[model samples]
Target: TVPGIGPVYTAGIVAEIGDISRFKNHNALAKFAGLTWRQHQSSKFSAEDIPLTRSGNYYLRYYLIEAA
Candidate 1:
């Protein structure tokens, strides 16, 4: 069992992320879960801090965050 992830959260995450083989890697899975940081680089100016994209499976993201 995961630290904070209960059965419901695990089920939700599994349901939302059906067929895990579809994703190429963990990065792809993270992107699908909307847990990736946004790109804040432009030419010579790069931002040190960036926010999450928040663009993907809402339920999955919610469960993951709540579990965390």
Candidate 2:
């Protein structure tokens, strides 16, 4: 989810950020990969409280989804 990150580079990052727990929480880890929330809960988004900008680590998400 790193903005402007290339595939090769992303692979390296995933290799390095092995123990993601090194980050405090999901939000903190999400921010590291530039995957944070955006947008506001306006009248249109009232149904949804918070919306995250797809800025989370895609690799992490992918692996978890696959493993699950």
Please tell me which predicted candidate would have the highest lDDT against the true structure: 1
* Total residue pair clashes for candidate 1: 0
For each candidate in turn, the TM-score is 0.92, 0.37
lDDT of 2 by residue, 1-68 (tens): 64556676567667846887799987787676555657666666554466656666776655443433
Q: What do the candidate models score in CA lDDT, each in turn? A: 0.93, 0.63
RMSD of each: 0.9, 8.5
Candidate 1 per-residue lDDT over residues 1-68, each given as its tens digit: 89998888889989999999999999999999999999888899989888999899999999999998
Candidate 2, poorest ten consecutive residues by summed lDDT: 59-68
Which residue pairs show backbone clashes in model 1? none
Please identify model 2 stretches exceeding 4 Å from their true place.
1-16, 19-21, 30-39, 43-45, 49-52
Q: Give the TM-score of candidate 1.
A: 0.92
